[model samples]
Target chain A: MTHGISMAGYMFVNPGEEILVPSLFWGNYNLSFINAYDAKIKPYNLFKGEGLDVAAMGAELMSEGDKKILLLNFPNNPTGYSPDVREMKEIISAVEQAAKAGKKIVVICDDAYFGLVFEEGIEAQSPFAWLANLHENVLAVKVDGPTKEDYVWGFRVGFMTYGIKGGTEALYTALENKTAGAIRGSISNTSNLSQSLLLEAFDSPTYQEEKKEKFNILKSRYEAVKQAMKNPDYAEFFKAKPYNSGYFMCIELKDGLDADVVRRLLIEKYSIGTISLNNLLRIAFSAVAVKDILALFDGIYSACKELTV
Target chain B: MTHGISMAGYMFVNPGEEILVPSLFWGNYNLSFINAYDAKIKPYNLFKGEGLDVAAMGAELMSEGDKKILLLNFPNNPTGYSPDVREMKEIISAVEQAAKAGKKIVVICDDAYFGLVFEEGIEAQSPFAWLANLHENVLAVKVDGPTKEDYVWGFRVGFMTYGIKGGTEALYTALENKTAGAIRGSISNTSNLSQSLLLEAFDSPTYQEEKKEKFNILKSRYEAVKQAMKNPDYAEFFKAKPYNSGYFMCIELKDGLDADVVRRLLIEKYSIGTISLNNLLRIAFSAVAVKDILALFDGIYSACKELTV
Candidate 1:
């Protein structure tokens, strides 16, 4: 875990440079910056709809030149809202422009919840695979591990790589040597056993069949929660938006209703716990049983009603 | 693994500091310095008869202040030799004196082969348990894993901690937080399955009995190898010193005989393979059968005799 983040930090920033991260990002990123690399991190706010404000992010990058690296997590955490493809393209374009202006732009695509984008025909394309080969100055890094994807959190197996690039063999060699040097220096080597198990799992004849079934189950649970939120009692408590994929969704509360207070009330008063993300209450739909989703929402609805009065 | 090393690196050295290591030490120590901490490594020579040259090491550290971090490996790999207590004390005292002189000394005791010291009664004590309490500026770190000790290599379980003066709550808190941060950042958490197996192995009622039996088997094998080296026919080709414990013994070749050439000749001509360290060949008595000890030496004896003229 430390290796993965530190590796990510080394890939994104140069010595004494600053990188931009979303304010609502995973907390480990902060630790990686301070503990792994002595670099600066600038936080950008997520827009009202819980997506990257492309215009604002572009402006920040434009102001900073190539000294800025942007880290994006979508099917975003704490709030499972993924931006539209148009928004993603805009973000990539802004990064490309920054790269063209003699600045090194590293884009870290953390596709943890990648395949679970909920909306039909709204598949999330990895910016890494797209941008890697296109621009020389633009370096794309993809950090994905089997922990969440394979539902094997204990495996502790992850992979990092230079997204598709049109680099010479020498360039690739240097990158691989440095990465291997990093791996060699850290824990010596990843567990050969873990790597073997992951390889076996991936190569299993039933892998695709198993993966599809699991994905459908989580997808159904997410849909159930989205539908349950439509009940009038809960409707006033949440601002509904298009939620296509992933295990979680965000509900923005009415003004004067603190998400933290509501979260505590839900836990203490209703024995239900949800994560508070600023003004939004993020519920993990995959964690609870599908049959219990309606009941869970009922508790949230009651808590909101009690708080409203 | 990477996180473990990175944290280990931090535990020993400060940012931009230099660490001294033996060329034969684990490759990851170099990785930890270059990849993880951006620190430099000064490689020192391992003496022929003695393991590490204490006087030369002292000369190196005397020039560099107490800010020097040294990684010491015993029953060393590629060449398994644990220094005598007198030599170890000399090294420790030098570091201690440097610390008292206002140098910050961090001694990382890579006790991977802690219990495997071959010499009877001359086994090195863990500098870890002593250094923590020795001086305010001195820190002794012990890095050990159940891999070698418990014969559970696939478990990938190990521990890192300050052995000496970390008795205070604040010290404990800082150590815990730093280690946790490293663990959280790297592999997230080690395999819970691996830890469970190790815990169970340690708690097994017959654990000590099993270990003792294995130790005796290795001891018998070591004695056989030592006895075989006493043959008049082999005496001129090899020189054997007192090796009371551990899995391996060193064989010093006669003058003008290269260890690497002799090793290849033994392998190709006699189908025996051994690790060569300069003019010395390391023979693993633990894994080799007692019955084969004479045959192994005869092979070496014949190879050296054939090549001598």
Candidate 2:
């Protein structure tokens, strides 16, 4: 599943070719693409004024060299921000614009934590649903897995689906063969037990009910975090990114304060661990219980107050 | 496990460098090393007069330009031959000799079948036990796992242990970090289920006894195949390679007869199947029952004669 994003970088993108990921991305993309394949990464601005920066992305897409690769992870990893239906449309249009400009775009949609939405009116579906089998110059590759969405974290089961148009049967077959061969060239095979367990679970009578129950539990935790953040006490510490989906949400440190000091102080003094990146602290709400959400935030707030002093 | 060989190629061996593998090798080594990494494969003849060609290997090790990687798999994949103690010593000496000649040789001992020795005189210990930390220039990397020896084929669990010399604590730590980083860059992680299952199995009451029982079953099958191959009725068809270990044994087609013809005829007419490679038919004794071994070979002999006519 991790290899889906990795294959796009290692197998599809040529060395030294620039892959335009967003400014805010899952850090492993760099390790997968740049460190693995020696490809360069160019970031498109993710957000402006608490909304997706579609215009900046469009400009970047049109301006970056043709025959480029774009990594689009919605309900994104760190920020947990999912684009609304209109935003999703605009994002696709940007890629289509590039394709219309005769630019070949291989869009890798990494839906790691798909369908974990906590808000209304924000469409939470795979870009695959629309982008696949849609265009000529745009090859939509959706990378997903049962690992997260299925709540089988230890299974490591993932999938890659290609929605490429403007190619004949032979061409498609060749492309699929290449994808399989790329997988073979990397990991020999996915573990069989995982695949079997997943298949059996899918066949089980309670699959949907179980999934919904799990989703509801996570939804409660997500809501708890949101309710706690509105307390006005954390406002002095950091402002969060516009987030309502996936496992995590990020808080941008206030007054340009660095997250490193705050992160270290929280771990050292308060024993509250969060992912520190740039000027933000990424809190994963998935594991935090509904009741513990506030206390977790309180510790972070205490750490910030101490660090600021 | 597959990437263990590849890591030696992609990480340890520089681009355009040469890797020395036996003429008879698990073919994926070529795919992983030469094709994937742009490294050249230098094959040393596996046999000289029905025994390991130590003289030829030593000569090649001496002549090949200083920086090289040697991939040693035993009990070998196709031939199932585990080198006797003397042969093992000769193999190590060749590397030590190269190191003494101011050459840096990274020996990747792919000990996939580490303990499955069929012959009495063959002490099939990993080369790491002897070669690791012994030389200044020779680095021994042993790759093995519970996948084969522990009777877990579907589980792709593997381990890679490095033994390098001329390194201080910091240097070694940095080297280990780089190796881990390489693994992280490739596959994000091996399946957590596999790791957990293996850990549980190790902690089980009868891990060693279970492994021993599995080993004994393979040993019986291996012996049966060996005894069956001794039938002079098959001599006209092919000459068996000196095999004493592992799952498979290969027979060289007499008079350079094409193995493809025999393989196809055996499948179509005799309803028997075998892996046809180069001029040899590789029979996997691991899966073939003790009583079925004779019939399997008889069918092959009948096919060979009919095809030859």
Candidate 3:
């Protein structure tokens, strides 16, 4: 997702141009744009109390007054927020309206978590599917991999796919040549040996079965986290951000305590590890041993209360 | 080498600044600097009939009149020319003189063919050893890998080491952070699995012995190539570029035949595969069998005569 953001940043948005990201975004996106491309970040509100604020996002996109990149990372890292189908359409419509106004729109859909859907209403599909040919100026780029989908991390393999509306095959070819030429200039290519492993995994008879088995386990963990948060005791220290899909659920510190301070106290006091971003504590329920999911939140509850104002 | 070029390019040279490369050099360097970094390539004469043209290269460097990057790859690809110590000193002297003239020179020594030396007089040692820290204004970067050195192309493991004169360890540390940050923005990092494989290769009991065995075979092929070119029949068609220390050697056409045309005809008529660049044909003897080395040149000689102008 960060690599996609970086490439899109340099390729599409020049230095000093504004990149409109949701207030809630993967931290790496900042590094990707600002550090890598020298582009500035302009944040729109991401939530109306844990539900996606498509209106604020649309308003920011429309009123930004310049051509910009729309980077949408679904089942977003840290927050694990995925837009439902209608919200996804609203996201596309914002870009479409902006593009229709003669503004160049580079819509990058970072689908790192493509199919980890546990929530009923939210869609796991990428916005790129419908938004790709949405407008002529919309250079839709989809960055994805079986790295997260197939549960392989060390592979370091992913792809950057493009779909630009009203572009000829020749145009796309040239764009591909540049992108690939950039890759050649960068890492040559991803590992051929890792590709072989992924290919074999794709061909294996148990591939779907194995993937389903892992997906179900993750789904169970999601349910466990939901149940864990239902405990009344945690309400005093933090407010749970609505999360139904993906690996994490964020807890906003309610007593106005610093998240990192609480995080340190949690480590020192309760021997629990959690990621503190801004004022939110992110809990990854994906790899939490099934038996320990509830106990993990219990630890968080105690740590928060101990340091509460 | 390409990655190092990309980093050294953006870090050292500005967008429009020119990079001076040898006339006979890897094609990727052009793409690496220009496509990725927007830096242009300025070619210096690499050969005076059969050896490194240090004097011409030195003159080009002196007269170009700008703070420039001098990129040199030794055990040279496609041409297989490694400078002897005296020639290397002459090459360093060019940079030294340029630095003395207040031109900030960033000398990148690409050591891809580090240990694959087959000649007695030529030094396979990196130019960074002597050039680095030699001048206050000169910054030296060496790019090398186990891909060619350990005969593990699939691993794709390489390194970038820097040496800047009078540079404190703190400055180097900061430079490293920026380099690492830039790399993070591009490809994250090289595959750790590949690193593990390379580490194991390093630890193997027969590591040095096995490398020596492979080195001996490549050296034998080099001798075979040098011996095969002694045929007077080949002399009429093409003059062999004086190659002594690497995988490939070039044959400059004597009869003014189109190298690309001869290349196509050779593939169709004699089932020969060789790289055609400008008026030269490159042959890699590293992988060719010793017995077939003579036959390969025979095919080239025949093709040259058949396609003669």
lDDT of 3 by residue, A1-309 (tens): 445555566567777888878787777776677866678988878888657888887777677466767777788777878888888888888878888887777777878888888988887688888777888878888988776788987677787889988889899898888777776776666777778888999999999999999999999999888888888877788888867777788899885788999899888888788899888999888879879998899888877777764
Q: How accurate is candidate 3 locally (lDDT)?
A: 0.81
Q: What is the interface RMSD of each candidate, in Å?
A: 2.6, 1.6, 2.2
Candidate 2's displacement at residue A15, Å, is: 1.2
lDDT of 2: 0.83
> Which parts of model 2 are misplaced by more than 4 Å?
none
Per-model root-mean-square deviation over C-alphas:
3.9, 1.6, 2.4
Question: Among all windows of ten consecutive residues in candidate 3 chain B, which has the lowest summed lDDT?
Answer: B1-10
Task: For model 2, state the Cα shift of residue A53 in Å.
Answer: 1.2
Q: Output the lDDT of residue B119, model 1.
A: 54
Q: Quality of candidate 3's docking, in CAPRI categories? A: medium
Candidate 3, position A217, lDDT:
94
Residue-wise C-alpha lDDT for candidate 2, range B233-301, written one tens digit per residue: 888878899888988899999975789888988888887888899899999889988888889988888
- Candidate 2: CAPRI quality band: medium
Question: Which candidate would rank higher by TM-score, 2 or 3?
Answer: 2
- lDDT sort, best first: 2, 3, 1
lDDT winner between 1 and 3, please give it. 3
Per-candidate local distance difference test? 0.73, 0.83, 0.81
- Which pairs of residues collide in candidate 2? none
On lDDT, the leading prediction is 2
